[model samples]
Target chain A: DAGVTQSPTHLIKTRGQQVTLRCSPISGHKSVSWYQQVLGQGPQFIFQYYEKEERGRGNFPDRFSARQFPNYSSELNVNALLLGDSALYLCASSLRHRGETQYFGPGTRLLVL
Target chain B: DQQVKQNSPSLSVQEGRISILNCDYTNSMFDYFLWYKKYPAEGPTFLISISSIKDKNEDGRFTVFLNKSAKHLSLHIVPSQPGDSAVYFCAAPDTSGTYKYIFGTGTRLKVLA
Candidate 1:
């Protein structure tokens, strides 16, 4: 089966702009999570959605938000983007909300100027 | 405070040798730990995982050793191949009882032929 898939493999945005990234979980997966990875750093949690409900959120600012659809796809939106927002946005899916292994997508690389 | 830490920024090992990567965590609430491997432009892939109840778990050529008393874990790759050269990250579920995961800074391993 195909693994987790993400859209718009790359993007370029300007400061104060808004961007949206998309992700589709593996078939039969119900939980989706988002993470941001800055250069030279590990992936940091952003948001997690299980059964289409917000199950957890990271320390990111209000400018970052995400939502999951009934089909278990997810979208990550960043408003008023800043240069600091430039990074790789990764999406992961798991069988359930807790204690399960998460499979990741190729990620969308965003650059903010 | 950083909950997970991978002290070594990079490592270089000769092919057919053993490559060891270390990680440390400050949170005792993490009941399980996982390792991920990432290529340059791809998302991290689930590697190996071990529960706190066990001290070691081994895969084909990869072994994960956990030391609960030390709040530490290590990933060992035997007969390291050039394909194994990539960034390795150690992660654990958040202590907040959520699905979020905390990841280390990652250690880049380069296996030379």
Candidate 2:
């Protein structure tokens, strides 16, 4: 089966601009999560959606938000981007089963200039 | 605050030797732990996982040990190969049912042949 897929493998945005990144979950996965990884650092949780509902949120600022579609595809939006927002935005999908593992997508690398 | 930490930013080991990567977590509420491996320009892939109920979980050449009392965990790869050169991240899930993951800063491993 195909793994999770993300769009716009790379993106360039300027400060004060808004950016949107997309992700499609594996064919049969239901739970999807988003993460941001800065250079030389681990990924930080952004948001999680299950059954197209916002299930959880991280410590992100109000400018960061996300939503999942009925098809289990997700989009991450960042408003008023700052240079520090430059990072790799990763999407991960997992089954709801106990002890289930989350599989990741290739990610969309956003560079804010 | 960084709840998870991997103090060693990088490690070098000879091929065919054992490679040990350490992780320490500060939150006692985290019950599920996972390890992921990542290469440049790609997203992280699940390597293995160990629940708080278990002390160790093994899969092929990969083994993860969890010490709840010490709030520490480590990943061991036996007979490390050049192909194993990559970054490893340690992650923990929220026990409050959010399923949010907190990740370590990651450790880059280089296997020399």
Candidate 3:
């Protein structure tokens, strides 16, 4: 009954550093997706995983990567973080990878300085 | 180029009045559309969605109307409440077999009490 959950509610990292954010999908959910939302902007798609496989990826650079686990949890890794990378990292889950309503978590706020 | 756009950056409406938020998309291949509501320092929450085949979908006081011809969609909230004040985003899945979503810039709504 609990919705999707994410860890490190807020994070601060220096430029060129590496960071990993985690997400646990809702109970019975099989798909997990990542998104980034900058200040005063809407969320942008990052990556989507279904059944522990990469189903989709956004226009982010190679520095950004993600993986889904057997338990349907997901981790978003960002290497060589820049000031531009500072944003709210959101994790969403759906019943499947296809067209379905995605439920989101509280999101991890990353501030790169 | 931004595939989805919300021209109005903000909207103010009195409580108990009708609140309307508009969105326009350039991708014709997008078949599914959705709306999300977000508060400060939180992730977006699913609002209402409408498929390309349907012109409208309603949930309680929320209604979404899709116009395929104009590639435009609108969310209508009847008897808007102060609790409804938040940022609204419109989104559609990528048509490139990615299942990733393209979201609008978002419109911030303020419901005056």
Candidate 4:
């Protein structure tokens, strides 16, 4: 089975622009989560969706939002991007357990100038 | 403040030697802990995990240990190989009922052959 898949392997944006990153979970996965990894740092949780609902959210600001589709795919959107927003955006999928191991995707590299 | 921390930035070991990476957390409510490995351009892959109920969980050559009293965890790779070189992160579930995770900065392990 294919693992978690993300689209637009790389992206570039300017300050004040918006970007959207997409992810499709594994064949039988029901939960999807988003994370951001800056260079030299660990991935930080952003949002999580399960069964087409917002199940969890991280410490990100209102500018960041995400939603799950009925088919279990997810999209993470960042508005008014800043230079500081440049990072690798990772999407992870797992079973619907409240807390469990997550399988991650290749991730989208976003660079904001 | 960083709730999860990996003080060691990098480590190098000869192939076939043992590789030990450490992590520490300040949150007492963290009941679940996990370790993940990441290659240069890929996302993190779950390596091993241990719940608060267990002190150690092993799989193949990877082992994870958790200490609730010290709020610490560590991952051990026995007979480390060059293929085992990667960035390792330690993470824990948040207690805010969001199913989110806080991650350590990560430790880069280089197994020299």
Clash count, one per candidate: 0, 0, 0, 0
Model 4: which residue pairs collide?
Answer: none
Which candidate leads in DockQ?
Answer: 1
Predicted structure with the largest TM-score when compared to the true one:
1
Angstrom error of the Cα, residue A80, model 1: value is: 0.9
Residues B11-106, candidate 4: write the lDDT tens digits: 999999999999999988888898989998899988888989999999999988888888888899998999999999998878878777789999
lDDT of 2 by residue, B1-113 (tens): 99999999999999999999999999998889999999999999999999899999999999999999999999999989999999999998877768888899999999999
Order the candidates by DockQ, highest first: 1, 3, 4, 2
- For model 2, the chain A TM-score is 0.96
Interface RMSD of structure candidate 1 (Å): 0.8
Error of 1 at B93 (Å): 0.8
What tens digits encode model 3's per-residue C-alpha lDDT throughout A19-44?
A: 99999999999999999999877788
After superposition, which runs of candidate 4 have C-alpha atoms over 4 Å from their true positions?
Answer: none
Candidate 1 per-residue lDDT over residues A1-113, each given as its tens digit: 99999999999999999999999999999999999999988899999999999999988999999999989999999999999999999999999989789999999999999
Per-prediction DockQ comes to 0.88, 0.67, 0.81, 0.79
Name the regions of candidate 2 deviating beyond 4 angstroms.
A97-99
Model 2 chain A poorest 10 in a row by lDDT: A94-103
True contacts kept of each: 0.89, 0.72, 0.81, 0.87
What DockQ would you assign to candidate 4? Answer: 0.79
lDDT of 1 by residue, B48-97 (tens): 99999999999999999999999999999998999999999999988686
How high is the lDDT of residue A69 in model 4? 93
Ranking by lDDT: 1, 3, 2, 4
